[model samples]
Target: MPELLSPRIDAISFRQLRLFESVGRLCSVRRGSEECNLSQPAVTQSLAKLEQMIGVELFERRPSGSYLTPLGRILYSRVVRMLKQMVTALFELEVPGGQVGAEAIVHRLTRSQVRSLVAIIEHGTFAAAAAALQITEGSLQRAARDLECNLRKNILFRSADGVIVTPAGIACGRRMSLALQEIDWAINEIDVARDIGESRIVIGALPFGGSVLLASMLDEFLATQSKVDVRIATESTSEMMQLLRDGKVDLVIGLTQETVGDDLVSQTLAETPYEVVARRGHPLTGQSHVNHEDLIKYDWVVGMPNSNRRNCFDRLFIDGPKPRTPIATSALLFIRHLLAGSNRLTLMTSYELQHETMLVRVPIDVPLPCPTIGITTRADWLPTALHRDFINLIKSRVNTRSIMGVTRTAA
Candidate 1:
């Protein structure tokens, strides 16, 4: 909404947005004036400024009354949603409920304050945030203080350990971001309608299911859709969730258990078991019955420790002599290459090694944990039509022999 999620606090006036919402919903300037408690000229003037600011003629002036343009209809719907969420979050987040009411907060809180709080928390320091926001330290500090006061919560505080965004502050920042994402979503839709922007979906991937899911679905998705960009960002579980909350990553497709948030929803896509994979001609391949003893005889490459696959790897040698100096890494690509060129063995799922035709799954009579892979998204996320199609493709392409019907769980 404001230059790709920087809080467009400067570009948009909350009061103006509320006025826009009122006019669009009532479909008449007179009705909007009544609801907003403004004179007819004031409402009309505000609407003109808003349309000029967003560079879209939001309304077609009708002889009977005002009506939404095609783009106006899109922006208006999202703005209505954004305003509702702001009003609810401001009240429910335990602001002095009756004193500083939700509607008051919506009108009182400036976008600068919202953007400032988010930037401070995300950058983890005042100076860094000020630099990134290109604002004075005094201005940033004042914005944060004003925001904390409005919410009646201790957001940013200096402890002996330096600076910290209190859990409350973190929660507030997330809530603040939700509304901005709503606006950004509207802008994306506007771009699509004008045929001037590339439709992009940023997917968070784990080392697991996305590979198989993408291997099967990506080419087809691109072939069928035009001017679309699909990006996959692989990061630690925590980072991806942060990205999702910040509205950078649209949806995460991978190990879902590590995520914990009140705003996320997850759906199980596949449940896959771990396998001990090695080069086809490796010594373990010759054994019809592979045991921990035989596995320990060879060197091993491993996924990051404490992960389900790594736990299975660790248990393999727990009962007997452990392998000497097993390599530990979270990078599946490195592990895959290491497995083919050397006598290293590792515990990974069949879905991960589907493309590695030269690698053989050792016939190990061992009990291993099966990891559940799925898609996690913000509960209020507005997935575009293309994204919805891609998800449907995944649901249809990855099924039956993989996993049965999908189940959705919310925060």
Candidate 2:
């Protein structure tokens, strides 16, 4: 954003990182300087700053040339991928300036300008975007203006409906968001390996996604991974799916979708069988075998509408009378408490109620299907070494639980 970023001289800059990538590719500081059209001394100084900032030496300086350090090679892969995404985004910005291709566009734009435009698009208002970035509104506007002036295109203009982004701006902002995603992953990969800066990973979990596995692992992860920032999103499956696609979440842990999109990949960890349940002393608790007719006589609680579990609940009585569903909720804690207090029944999995003492199975003879619990990540996702190990640990734990004789549960 500055000749070098301010507020923190050690902060990463897109320009400096691009230079680092150049040197990594050429394996010669002089060649990197020539390719970037910068003085060799300036290139060396920028690389030094980057190395100091990351607390790791990226290159082995020698008379012949520069060579990558061990960590540098691991980091180089992510940076290369990041630049490729940026190049693709630049190519897509052929609108507004039909004469400017990716080659020309990359030369004309600055990281700050792209940052401002992306902020505007994401927040829908310059004021909000500025606040989000912790910068002045005037500075944000100036950056956006410079972007338009450089490209000779009006990215945004005031209309009766308020500010409107031109098609070029929309395209640029959309693609840049994706490019920024690569940047995020790159940084996450570095921080995790270096263990010096904060590493962040967001996990999206559906309501019944064998999230209990997360509880035990979460405790150990927090106790151990102090520098790693972990965020869990317990939103609906659809919301989580969209988040995963957009790179807002690192991965999703949930019921395996019936059909995964081409851009997504899923792995089955375990299958849990679903069971109809009621309070320990409920009338249906003593039934040797209960049918839909007997079960519908009392009030019940079910999962959120349209959820896989709820859909399965619907099929239980597909042939006849519907039960009086007094409540519909996805929160297991609330469901357990509500069932304990009322005569209401519910459909649940053994894994979900593993430690509960009040609820017991309402034995039924129907052919119940089980849900497969697993992890879903972007097909393009490239996890850091540590990240991959963590996911593997989850899979292994689920399998171990199954081996220990935990019943397979269902959605």
Best by lDDT: 1
Which runs in model 2 stand beyond 4 Å of their true positions?
Answer: 1-11, 37-42, 90-100, 146-161, 164-175, 181-195, 400-411
Compared with the true structure, what per-residue lDDT tens digits does model 1 show for residues 6-118? 34335777778888888898899999999989999999998898777666788999889999999998888888888877776676666776535777777778888888877
lDDT of each: 0.75, 0.75
Which lDDT tens digits does candidate 2 get at residues 278-382? Answer: 888788766677887888888888888778788888988888889998789887788889989988988876566565678877778897768777899988678
Question: Could you estimate the TM-score for every candidate?
Answer: 0.83, 0.82
The collision pairs in model 1 are none
Q: What is the lDDT of candidate 1?
A: 0.75
What does the lDDT read for residue 19 in candidate 1?
A: 87
Worst 10 residues of 2 by lDDT: 1-10
Model 1, runs deviating above 4 Å:
1-10, 60-67, 88-92, 98-100, 158-165, 258-262, 296-299, 311-325, 399-411
When summed lDDT is taken over every stretch of 10 residues in candidate 1, the lowest stretch is 402-411
lDDT of 2 at 97: 46
